[model samples]
Target: MAASKIAIYGAIGANVAIAVTKFVVAGITGSSAMLSEGIHSAVDTFNGVLLLVGIRLSQRPATAEHPFGHGKELYFWSLIVAVLIFGLGGGVSFYEGIQHIRHPEPMRDATWNYVVLGLAALFEGTSFFIALREFRREARGRPFWQALDQSKDPTTYTVLAEDSAALAGLGVAALGIWASHRFDMPALDGAASVVIGLLLAGVAVLLISQARGLLIGEGIRPETARAIRSLAMQQPSVQDVGRVLSMYIGANEVLAIVDVNFKDGTATGEAADAIAAIEQQVRARFPMIRRLFIEASEAPVDAAATA
Candidate 1:
């Protein structure tokens, strides 16, 4: 966990500095779009920092009071980052766009603006690609965002989402900056900023939804359910599987409650042995599973019964 956070911290530091430079350039040139991108980068810095804090706190060892540890703090803090992105980045960009429409200012030192914008674009691209490479090694089979969207681990997903968004934002900013200078239409820059704002807001909404699911103890993926059910049913002594309930207890880790039904003729102690054996098998197959609590039932418990 500590190792994971180091990279995020580096990214945050880079973004904060990049944002400062972006704002300085934007202010000198009076380019609304550059200003919007600058604000967006600042929000990125905050999000990255918050993600680090969340990931750090979540790694605390489980205690008697927090049997589940502080893992949920990652989700809570990541959600807060999302809210900040929306309220701060999105809100400011929208207002700037509206302001530009009513009383637009002529951009100055446009040549200098291009140089600064180009450097910022390169920095953003480097950061974005680094994030993609980080996840690429693990996300080969899964689509780019699919793993992130379905991930239960808050810290990991937040970092991935933030990186992806940063890359996209840079591209948007580049277009806005170029169009504003190319066509001598400064308003286009502000329009691009507005579009970037919408994109950031969309990402924020997505982050919040994922966090909400974790907070409310969303069920494990269907594939997880099937994996649990199929594996338990494979046990020789198991007659049936009653129900399998799984919840994410850490980033990509799950705790499962499994009900196993053995033959009615079997002794209770024997059934207990069967359940224990099945649990061991489950752990062997799914190492990411952190907890497995089995309920031995002689007769199978149906889905309705468990519900």
Candidate 2:
């Protein structure tokens, strides 16, 4: 979470400064691509704020009405951020590009656009590296795509995705600006804006998919579940392990319920002790399992039926 905060803060600061500069340059040069980039940065800044709000809200304590706490708040806000990117960012950029293409206006000198773009690249690049570093650290030694697929925390990856899109948008904007000046064709700049809009829309769709999955209650990986089942089976009083159900209640919190069948003659006291021991061992191995429920069941009719 600390890493998430650092990445988001860096992004917000960089985007705020770059958005202002891009808008100023766009105003002076009347460059459609630059204006679109400005809108992108502004939208990113606001998205960063929404992420922060999500993080804060997700930290709220669990209550009677909400037994799982407010952890899903982060996923909810992440979805909203993706929607805003698609709407305010991508929609506006696409519209602006079409308008510019229809009413092609000659651009002013390209010197300021180049200078501003260079600075924007530097700032945006720094933020991107920061986010990538944090994400990689969290991923440990896992493959990038695999780690991303299993990640429960939305803030870290969301920033990484946004920065990645921002960097790509910058490249597109730079190329479009150069092409317009070199060919003396202003419509190319609008074309660049269109490309950027499509890029953002693509990123938003991916983000929405991920956030939606988490918001609806994603579970731990199959490997983790199998490991946990094995751990439960290792208990002497346990005859077999049945269902091992798990769900992520927060970024670092998990709630798991396991059905264990005990030996037919096992005393209730012995079952209780075994359950306590099992809980301790599981929690020791996977500290993220904040809440665990172990249900004792009758001996399985089919001993081969295991989780």
Candidate 1 lDDT for residue 216:
79
lDDT of each: 0.76, 0.91
- How do the residues 186-263 of candidate 2 rate in per-residue lDDT, one tens digit apiece? 999999999999999999999999888887888888888898899988888898898789888888899999999998
Model 1, stretches more than 4 Å misplaced? 140-146, 299-307
Candidate 2 clashes between residue pairs 3 or more apart in a chain or in different chains: none
- For model 1, how does the per-residue alpha-carbon lDDT over 1-307 read when each residue is reduced to its tens digit? 5535655765687688788988998888888877887888898888888888788788899999999787778878878998998899888887887687567677787786677667776776676656656665556589866866665665566666766676677677778777877888877877877887888889889888888888778777788678888887876667788768877767756788988777655655556666777778789987778788988766543434445
* TM-score of each model, paired residue for residue: 0.89, 0.94
lDDT of 1 at 209: 88
Q: Looking at model 1, how many pairs of residues clash?
A: 1
The model with the greatest TM-score is: 2
